[model samples]
Target: MATVIISALLFVFVLFACRSAWKRQRNGCCGNDIQRLKKVKIKGDKCRDYPYRSLLHIDGMTCQNCARKIENGLCSIEGVCATVRLDQKEALVRMKRPLPESLLCGAVAKAGYTVLKVDFLPQSGHRSL
Candidate 1:
């Protein structure tokens, strides 16, 4: 009787695990069924307004929702505007002022993603007319 009960419990556990895996595959690793996320608009619309720019290579972004989450996280910072490219697994981040690398990494990390690298781009010479 004890062996039978143990086997049944193990079978139920396996069933639950299989169901969870199916959900992840169907709804993405983030488990969000929503296809699109609400766009996060930055204060400055023009590229010239942001003098500083950086590229972040991120990992663990499985879908558009993950990209949007990372973008939202970085854009939440003051003076920061971020656009994530899900296919490339990178983000182009622009800021009005220079921010520390730690801050940028922290933002991505907050969204359950890992920042593998950060490359600072040369300052843009374009000025607002």
Candidate 2:
């Protein structure tokens, strides 16, 4: 009788785990059921307005919602505009002034993503009028 009870408990535990996994798969890996945030628009007349640019390779982004979350978080910072590419798992960030890599990483972290690498691009030749 004890062995039968133990087996039943084990079966119940497995069933619960499977249900949780199915829910996650239906919602998303992040398990965010709420609607996605709106895209943030970069406020600049021309690309030259943002002289500094960086490419951030991020991990733990499983869907478009995750990408938007990271993009919105980065764009909320002053002098920063970010666009996340979900397929590439990277974000292209443009800033009016140079921002420290730590700050960029922190912003991504706030959105529950990990920044694996940050590559600062050289300033382009375009000059703002």
lDDT of 1 by residue, 1-129 (tens): 999999999999999999999999998877786546677777756655788999999999988889989999999998998888999999998888999999999999999999999999988867321
Q: Which regions in candidate 1 have their CA more than 4 angstroms from the true location?
A: 44-48, 125-129
Q: Which candidate is the best by lDDT?
A: 1
Clashes of each: 0, 0
- Report the lDDT of model 1 for residue 109: 98
> Which pairs of residues collide in model 2?
none
TM of each candidate vs. truth:
0.86, 0.77
Q: When superposed on Cα atoms, how far off is each prediction in RMSD?
A: 3.0, 3.6
For candidate 1, the TM-score is 0.86
Question: Candidate 1: deviation at residue 113, Å?
Answer: 1.1
* lDDT (10s digit) by residue, model 2, range 9-123: 9999999999989988888776666375677766755545688999999999888789889999999888897888999999988888899999999999998899999998987
* True-vs-predicted CA distance for residue 128, candidate 2, Å: 14
Runs with alpha carbons beyond 4 Å of true place in candidate 2 = 1-5, 40-48, 125-129
Q: List per-prediction Cα lDDT, in the order shown.
A: 0.89, 0.85
lDDT comparing candidate 1 with the true structure: 0.89
